[model samples]
Target chain A: MNPRLSLNQATIKHADLATALSLTAEAGITSIGLWREPVAEVGLGRAATMVSDSGLRVSSLCRGGFFTASDPAERARALDQNRRAIDEIATLAEAGAPGSAPVLVLVAGGLPAGDRDLASARARAAEAVGDLAADAAGAGVVLAVEPMHPIYAADRGVVSTLREALDLVCDLPAKVAGVVVDTFHVWWDPTLPAQISRAGAEGRIASYQVGDWITPFPGDALLSRGLMGDGHVDFASITRLVLDAGYTGDVEVEIFNQELWDADPAQVVARVVKAFDETVAGQL
Target chain B: MNPRLSLNQATIKHADLATALSLTAEAGITSIGLWREPVAEVGLGRAATMVSDSGLRVSSLCRGGFFTASDPAERARALDQNRRAIDEIATLAEAGAPGSAPVLVLVAGGLPAGDRDLASARARAAEAVGDLAADAAGAGVVLAVEPMHPIYAADRGVVSTLREALDLVCDLPAKVAGVVVDTFHVWWDPTLPAQISRAGAEGRIASYQVGDWITPFPGDALLSRGLMGDGHVDFASITRLVLDAGYTGDVEVEIFNQELWDADPAQVVARVVKAFDETVAGQL
Candidate 1:
């Protein structure tokens, strides 16, 4: 198994924190990317302790952004939640093994219901990120803004290109805010190579997530992501692009497929390790 | 009905050429974009007579691309078929009412099966278009390259952005090789306004197609498009951008929704005209 391969907890969504950590460690994986819900379920302190005890690195926190709210009260609550998430990142980064990145992966929310103004929705997202930039900087956490595929622009994400994500964070200090280049969302972008290089030059590549886009597309658009090598994504090529872009962090295998979530997590971790080695590790 | 509005035949997929023509004309639409399959079914000569008799302008032909074939014989076959399509465009343009456009809409095919080399496949598509440019020039027909949404990059179109499509044809004469600016394919693009302007400045805006991107994305990804007002697309904004870019051509409403397909053609035409008027024609 590749030492740099991290099993993102979403791959085994049903598993508790303890089981997720054990499953990952048992498979000889040295790192994990965690979701806030599971960590909250175990209590952040207890989760930090388990991560420290397992001697595994926390690659990044799964998410912290959904910042496109138009309502003032809802916006305040979201900001408060993000600040808490920042503190959790600080705690987890302290407890985890050395080399764990204090990174919070952000998925900017989509258009508000019945709202047709995409420009304003995107502006709200950027402003929200600006609102939280100071908190992230104070906590020494990087807010990694992820660009989702355009298919999700209506209900999941408005930022749909690396160029756009990079543009949103360019004004901020790279150490405080960056971008996540997930293959499932961006593998089809023609300008990906150039934009990856630009992100590297700007020093804003916060995390790298790996997943494949399968054909005969699944019924659920969100669960359409497949395990690496099981779909059309050329992992090695994208992995090479990331390496060339100077990203040295753990590569998280973050598939959202229902089949993988339903299967034994231990087996899933094992398969992930093999897939990462076969398809991505060689490039690294 | 809006004088600039044209009904694209695929929106009424079950309708034969005659039925599509009559339905479009009965709805007071003065123009129609035709699909080659239906035109071929009636035989080009007979189809031309029917279009001429209907007194409706031919905005453009449905398609003349699929040019990403890796096999040498397959590539040659696709080029030959495109040449025929160009000839058909000329004949149809001559047969239709004044202001008919001799334009062939091009959908660059996806990556070859079991092939993950997107860059090479895209290069092949561009090369094929380059090969067809002279034939198009000879026929006085514009090959309108369309950039599909990135979701279809693996199975439908490797060209996934208007910028890339424009780049592919930038070196060629704009009159010989242009682009189709479809709202559904490009509404999510942040750079759409600028690209549309560039296409217009370069005299490459051969056709404009309008369709909305509905969410709760359907099971069949290909059939997910909706009528103009039924989804997230702000057609007025896009239509304004196209008009501001100096486009005076017909706006073809090209939807692929199964619900619309299953409806009566006359009713579908009525709904399409209403959607276009309420959502798009106002801008025009």
Candidate 2:
């Protein structure tokens, strides 16, 4: 089978939900990764139907977890929002018809206020995931925990390494937990190969996202992602490792850059597709 | 004995070499850490004599390594520069009355040609250090490998963990190889406690530096370090671990902030002294 390629909506931020959907369809890409805010803006039910009619597969939902908050009320709010997101994902999967269940990706939140205690933060994140897993399982949505880079340790995700993510998931049964290995986050890790093998062996490989790293221009951590072949990451080796890890899943191109967003949406998709092809060819 | 505190010259960057010396002496900090460019600006021999006459101990020279270049000519240049740094360190030690040797801190350079091949870069660094170790021993100066943060793995030092630093140093004899544990680079590491014990057991603990983690800033990779208590690092716990590891040396404050650099040099020194006192009292 030809390699499955999915376009994460962030890569085409220049387009609205309708525009992104239409552009993606025109580009002949069969799968997409959707973000929550855009879906909500278009109304989840309407958005689900739009995607359904488009005949595109939903590879994974953008995210669902900000489990690290100091206030109990805030934590409860995050869980409630996540449960609602899971329900929406279940609806979308059903609307998309049989044999099309998109993975629900979880981005475990960073440290709580006045809390530099990483150990406790990690414990809290794992506990939150355990609570969310039951609902996710019932909905037939595979929960994929994406371990973000260490730079995001303070404000994004506490699960910075695949080993750490696997350890967290080990508490739950294999069917309940899996991990998403994003090249942008795990490329710099020294323990990538071993962790990838472990994830695959345990049946915990759920999603595999790709993006390159670009040093942010100071105070812009959230959006400085690089285009493929634009940075120093070894995508060829990483893709080989993921494929070896038994990850026969969609290769999602997820970039968050203002430069790409400002360009034409079709141009961005075409460029990424070309890069993805080159990456597979070992020319990257 | 009261814990002796030292000021790394980078913390008071605005002050000229002579001014920093006078202010540091007046602040009751009898130990100092000097960087190469500043030493070069004010002739190395003259700077050494000035430091000696001020009746202050030179705790460690700031650096002497950038061994990640792949080109033969560039590699030779790096080694030659390191030799000169070693010679200057020897001159400083000799110029000071007998029995006052300073440790030369080494930051093994990052990837060569901007390439991200960590294992190869590490091998190159180890080979270069083996050559420099003999010169360091001959000059009565100990070479201290300072493992930078993992965030710097792509562009700075590949030796991001204390365990990795110790392993790199193991290539040399015990007398010639040692490691510097800086709080800023290592406090977040999960294996820090165990690594500290290992370093102590192997008699490789060379210098102990302190700084905090300021958010949302890159701070010039080598510079832009935070002041203690102003960031997230647990200074007291790390210091205790270092002490437990048989490190009975001066705790040096090394901040590299634009705000602090613009302040009065005397004010910066005073603030550091206060922070050091508070950190020790709070941590102990």
Best by DockQ: 1
Per-residue alpha-carbon lDDT of candidate 2 for residues B164-280, written as tens digits (9 for 90 to 100):
889889868767779999988887666789999999999888788898876665535455467777766767778888888888777778877888888889998888888888775
* Stretches of candidate 2 exceeding 4 Å from the true structure: A94-101, A215-219, A280-284, B93-101, B218-224
Off by more than 4 A, model 1: none
Give the true-structure RMSD of model 1: 0.9
Interface RMSD of 1: 0.7
**Residues A23-113, model 2: lDDT tens digits:** 8888887778888888889999899989888887777787898887768899899999889888877777676534455578899987776
- Please write out the lDDT profile of model 1 over residues B1-284, one tens digit for every residue: 78999999999999999999999998899999999999999899999999999999999997988989899999999999999999999999999999999999999999888999999999999999999989999989999999999889999899999999999999999889999999899999989889999999999899999999999999899999999888899888888989999999999999998999999999999999889889988888
Separate DockQ for every predicted complex: 0.84, 0.42
Report the alpha-carbon TM-score of model 2 versus the true structure: 0.92
| Candidate 1 TM-score versus the reference | 0.99
